[model samples]
Target: MVCKLPAVFLLVPGIFLACTSLKPVQQLSEEARRGLGHFHKLGYNYAETCTMDCTFQKVRTFTVDRRLNCECASYQKADSVVWGLFRAMEQYWMGLSELASPGLTSYDLSAPVQSLHASEFVSLSEGEVSAIQKMAEFAVNTSTGRFRSRRILHYMKDADPHLRLLTEKLGFVLEQNLLGLLEIQQEEWYTHYKTQTINSELNAMEKEWATEKHYQLVEDAEKIRLKVVSLVAMLDLIAEKHHSLAVTAEKIGSENFRNITAALSDELKDLYVVFEQVNE
Candidate 1:
């Protein structure tokens, strides 16, 4: 719970009123950041998930060209792009959480090594991408041996749209790209295992073993799908919450702001509970 601060609404040209309500917003943004911290693992899983296409390419190379070609990084570009998007979005939310606080803070990003590649797969405009990417640069500029002040309402208003778009794109990448990969993997598993089970040359024991493996694969794939889908839902919720906040910016501490935020807090808590189960 945010401890109430008295009468900040009277100070700083109505900005402190905004700050007084920001702890919840900051908490929301922090939750968003925590959810994506495991993106490296997500990217690795995307690369390694089995696919019949990958197998076919490898086999064709070895057979036709007499070459031992292991396309181990088949999804490396997609992984890198996802990594870049995650990093950029993380920076934005992290900055938002920091900038919305009541006190001053500083953090360095001057020499942060992160890929920020945008691809044709991303449907964002160059200007929108640039705006999100600058969040890191903003941190670098503000935190260069100086404790920068917070309580900026205009900054929040400015970033809200671009950040919402980023949240959306992240969901799209996860659902469409990663989930698509998993679907292909499941299909490949079905084809591979079913073929073995139906092969007349295979003994009953071998066919049974193949059938068992197929069932296992199906179960595992379902688990991954549920996890990824939950992430997509979380992203959608974040965007919705952010949109609500942005549109109600002028109402900072009004009844409208309080009502929307109160409802959103409950929604966030429910989603956070869901994430706690998978955080392990």
Candidate 2:
């Protein structure tokens, strides 16, 4: 009879095969982790920009109302303040849109997070890769559109029927922006995989081996989407607040006007929370 090989001889090759099988998955997980981090950073930048813009819009309306009604000297003061705020907000948006000096902006807000090129993830389905690419492109275009919308508001007169029309237009643009973001969040791929959690029963080896690149991408995308949803909610609140403030400027000193301003200020604070959460 032939002699049988020892158990250790069989075990060595099994271990080697297991490690070899897991190598590509390990690389994919690491790459996906880094990419997801970058996506969060980009989403944070967008939130910050939106918060700044919303605050500026509110203050601008208040200052312009004061300028329209005050004596010459007071009007000059209000105008100066409005001008200063406008310039600051404009430059901030430009920086966020990646149109300003890179040395000045701390974050690279220019491009969308790139998730599709990880070589270890070569097994990722074409549909999954396409979905990520589409989301990235939507983010870039949305940022650009927001900046343009703000620019349009910069030149609009803060008086009368014109301001009403302007605020309406502004609100519409904001609504469209929010809707676009919601569409991405509602995409089948994002919704399908967002509920999946890491398996607790998976052993360390199995955990690494079973990691799916598509799941990682979907999770990261959902994080960005949630940040965006928060931001859009805040912006929508701001738009309504500004419209109300603009429409009621004639009663600026009335009790009702004061109450509206107080409410708007509280809402603005809520908007800041979105930015703070992302930074933290």
Best by TM-score: 1
In model 2, the Cα lDDT at residue 153 comes to 31
- Global Cα lDDT for candidate 2: 0.40
Candidate RMSDs in Å, in order, are 16.6, 32.0
Prediction 1 global C-alpha lDDT: 0.60
Tell me the tens digit of each residue's lDDT in model 1 across 1-280.
2332222222233222222345555665666666555454342355665434566546534556555344647566676777777788778778877765645333433233123223333344445445444554444434431222224446567777887888788888888888887787677778878888789999999999989988987876676666676666766776686677676664444576556656665766676555445544
Q: Mark the 10 consecutive residues where model 1 has the least summed lDDT.
A: 9-18
Q: After superposition, how far is residue 94 of candidate 2 from its true place, in Å?
A: 14
- How many backbone collisions does model 1 have? 0
User: Lowest-lDDT window of 10 residues in candidate 2?
Assistant: 18-27
Off by over 4 Å in 1: 1-21, 37-44, 50-69, 72-74, 105-151, 272-280
Tens digits of per-residue lDDT for model 2 on 59-177? 43554443323224543454344334333433332332333222221333223323323444343445545544554444444444434333323422143344344334433433354
Candidate 2 Cα errors over 4 Å, as ranges = 1-213
